[model samples]
Target: MKSSLRLLSALGLSLCITTLSAKELTVYTYSSFTSSWGPGPQLKTLFEAQCDCTLNYVSSDDGVSLLNRLRLEGASTRADVVLGLDDALMEQTRALGLVQPHQLELSNWPLNPDLAWTDTDFIPFDYGYFAFIYDAHKIETPVDSLEALLNSDASIIYQDPRTSTPGQGLMLWMQKVYGDDVQQAWQRLARNTVTVTKGWSEAYGMFLQGEADYVLSYTTSPAYHVVAEESDQYQAALFTEGHVAQIELAAVTAPSQNVELAQAFLSFLLSEDAQTVIPTTNWMLPVRTDIELPEVFLQTQPQRIGFSPEETEAGRETWLRTWRNAVSR
Candidate 1:
């Protein structure tokens, strides 16, 4: 039965691959996900092998721009699918009615509070807790918590909340940890911020270039150094206040000519074959529990403080204003 469906899916899954090719599916995505080094390249190869379709990716600067690009294009977009939008922006994406609803099946999903994402329009593929990463060789004393980050004098690089998801996660983390004093907290953090870039790729690159002592990144970051580069000199600081959880997702655009095929692709994203590549390629946790991770990831993944749709919608303006006012000075 499985082999037969696999064969049929390839024949039927072709949406919009290229010019004059009807069996193609165009996906709008963030650069990192589609970069030759990122999951996008492997994803296209693997999915196409099964779907008999050409998978083309039109990448934006980052996830925020990924959505903004869609909003800017409105209904005329040729993209049948979107990958790399996060739980943070789902409220805006859903409110804008930018995507059609989907009910994709899952494997290794659970009934846990942390895994509960109720939106039918967007499907969660993977999740990770946001953290500040540092070079063990550079900083003898790594700051752990939100308060620790602000109070310490160590130089850091982070993304702009208006442009990057991890930067926005840090903003929300500060708000969640320091509710009424969010403004005061950002004021203090701004003192330590050496530079703020427009996207994750830039910020992480700056850190790699030794622009700062640390950079805002995922807990799974060190796993790359440990597993890929055969180095153990990097680490994610253990925080007193748990880190903010970011669930990365994919969705079918409302204007798509093919619904079931798009939905099938979303399902393919969560399957073991795809999830297996996500941890190393995308540098985040796989949504499936049974998938084994590099022991480094298991050793370093932080505790999560999850958010709801309501909380995300209610907090965007206040968080952005607080971050902007503190740093603009």
Candidate 2:
């Protein structure tokens, strides 16, 4: 009888462990998205409560870092879902064949009409327009256009194009505005550039410290200050040339063991519950058009202009080369 009892106990323990392991869902995303302040905690709770599964978030430093991590891990990645890559990386990510089709019917889902999203492999959760943010108190008159910002001798801090998405957006912005004279434009802008940081946080932090007149960031960036700090001092300068839009996306890994669960999370990201949590937490506009946004979003709508994913991918290397040579001089 004693031997039988011990055997039963060991079997029960093994069963419990197996059950727990079966229900876990792993997601790889950026550090900020999974931080205490970001949506990861709340989303994890919400997802786990509904699905009876443990949601795990493995984080990298930023969006670019997430992409790099996947490249290193390849088909051996444990991630079921990969989140936080932007449209700028869509073509590249697709080319790598790392992610599988989400299999969600996004048609008539109340997504932003401006997006015109039709990708089968990835889903857009949020988006924001790239703009130069400045303190209203310091700059009584902000540059009205990209041409003005690049032409003026106003000391500016921006991220490195090779390293950061905002920097890439500005590179695309410069190309859109300057066309054939983009190299000359880069040289002119380099003359007054306070310094180029490796990432958005460093450049924006330096700008907040009054190190530069403007910092390249999302138009929705000022909404963070308005909602969180109750100070409306920071604002994104609306350029006459329009702004480039960055749509943050989520995808299921090709090697996912839990394809159904991964697809559920992608669908959840587009759901009303998740959409409501994204804006304030991520500091970007929800992709859903039907959801009500903060007043700040209503007030600061900038016209969107940008290259398609194909165009971005094709031109990126040449553009980076041009940026490097122009800025170095």
Candidate 3:
């Protein structure tokens, strides 16, 4: 009886250890990333198969909201990894000191040369250029340039600069195009502006419902329509003023207990298997160049023009103020 009791206790302790070792890695990201249609489901399965851990995603409204959520939760956040922050948010997120280095040697990965990635803390997974998407059937003569769009009375919808990356991209684009006259440009664009949404999904959905002639979104937005719906009605209006790029990044949270697992997920993100899932599901260009893309993905490359990550951080507050004051009018 004594021997049997001791053996049972040993088995119970072993079971506890096994349960503890089978960990769960929680990643904080945007809602779209974890949606059924997004890469989250497939990525969760892929990562779990190798790591022997459950991959969990906690989502906010959008990228900017991801930063806001971190600020609210700070060190108390349960996130082992934070993903979906764009390059523009890098400086702000880093200043919080809530994220640790990924510690992976990316020299072997086939990162895009155009990215010129040198940051050690944040890892870029995907990128896209901001553009105004319009239905080709409705708008036969779409505005050819930002100046033309602003100069015309064509109704438009865009995301809020404070809450959405694409809206921030448009803010940077306006500043790049109009220079010191950006205030007047915003005031001008406000004339025909249908509404400013808190997130990209709302604005894009409104556009799809024919609420506006054009909607501010990624250049790759139409790729989803072409590939999934077998329709090419949606199109990005290329601007002669050039477009700003949003590079989505992921990093290991400093407060996480699962540092090894977080880093593993980040490493897996750059792998061919993961990169293959990003383009169609996320509707963005993969960081790796080796992935073969659909014809629509190949066609949307526009002239890239925007502030560097440092420049964006420096002027962000001032630009936000300018946008708020102008749009209020």
Candidate 4:
């Protein structure tokens, strides 16, 4: 009878282990996950607790690189979900159809109607406006407009548009403001251009180190500088031409076996708890209308440049061609 009881106990333990293992969900995202600035850990902890699932994160350096990896993996990829693709790459990802539409019960959550894209192919997590982050001490009189930057003596560092989201955003912002005369605008900017880094951090680092007078970054960049780093050297300039607002999105992979869990994770991202953490950590504006702005953000409300996703898609190729021509000249 004792021998029989031992066998039953071993079986029960094995079943419990199997049940726990089945609840784990794996997520793939950008390398930003490793930073305390990112939402990865918080997301993992919250989701695991709510859904009784273990959260696994796989990270890559950039969104485009992650998308490319997803393509290479086809339907067999281990990633159940992907986060960090922005408006710039949304069309490309949508065209690839690598992600399935997320049908979550988000009726209780108040999402910005304007931020939604195509029946929830992707959900906007956080957003921010793009601007020039410059050293207040280095620049005697900071350039207040795109034209000023074009004509000023201050060295400017920006990421390359083809590779960086902020670079693409600035490119689109220029096109929106300059219209048909955008080629000329690029010509004007090229004259004062110092260098183009591969990503935002590198460009911002150069600005902080005083290598350049300005770096292309978000309007909330000053918030990070003040609250996180406790340095006032960096401040985002208010430009007359308006700032480019970029929204980062999250989506469920088409082949993900854990669709319900992925959808739950998406809903949790927009929760008040998650939204509250974003301003402090990622330097982004919360999509939820109810969340209060942090003190640093209260000083600088990001200016909205008038450019729709449709306009962005229509002009992107032409703008790139013109940008290349202008750079070469």
The predicted structure with the larger lDDT, 2 or 3, is 3
Give per-residue lDDT, candidate 1, residue 74: 83
What is the lDDT ranking, best to worst?
A: 3, 2, 1, 4
TM per prediction: 0.91, 0.90, 0.93, 0.86
Q: What is the lDDT of every predicted structure here?
A: 0.80, 0.83, 0.86, 0.75
Alpha carbon lDDT of residue 164, candidate 3?
A: 80
lDDT (Cα, tens digit) per residue for candidate 1, span 215-326: 9998888888988999978888889878888889899998888666676677677666787889999988887666788788788656777467678778898778877887
- Where does candidate 4 stray beyond 4 Å? 1-22, 112-118
Estimate, for each residue in 1-329, the C-alpha lDDT of model 4 and write its tens digit.
22332332323212222222247677888776547567677766655665577888887766666777888898999987888878777777777878998764444466666565444678787998899988887666788888788878778899878767788888888887888998898888877778887777778778778788888998888887789778887789999878888988888999998776666666667677777777777788888777888688878875688566666767778888999998899
Output the better candidate (2/3) by TM-score.
Answer: 3
Error of 3 at 42 (Å): 1.0
Each prediction's total of clashing residue pairs, residues at least 3 apart in sequence or on different chains, is 4, 0, 0, 0
User: How much does candidate 1 score in TM-score?
Assistant: 0.91
Deviation in Å, model 4, residue 266 alpha carbon: 0.6
Would you give me the overall lDDT of model 1? 0.80
lDDT tens readout by residue for model 3, 1-329: 22332332323212211323438999999988999999999988887776677888999888898889988898899999999999999998898897888776666577999999879899999999999999999889888889999999899999987888888889999998888999999999999999999998899899999999999999999999999999999999998878988999999998989876677677778878889999999999999888999999999789999898899999999999999999997
Better of 2 and 4 by TM-score: 2
Error of 3 at 322 (Å): 0.2
Off by over 4 Å in 2: 1-22
What is the TM-score of candidate 3?
Answer: 0.93
Instruction: Estimate candidate 4's alpha-carbon lDDT, on a 0 to 1 scale.
Output: 0.75
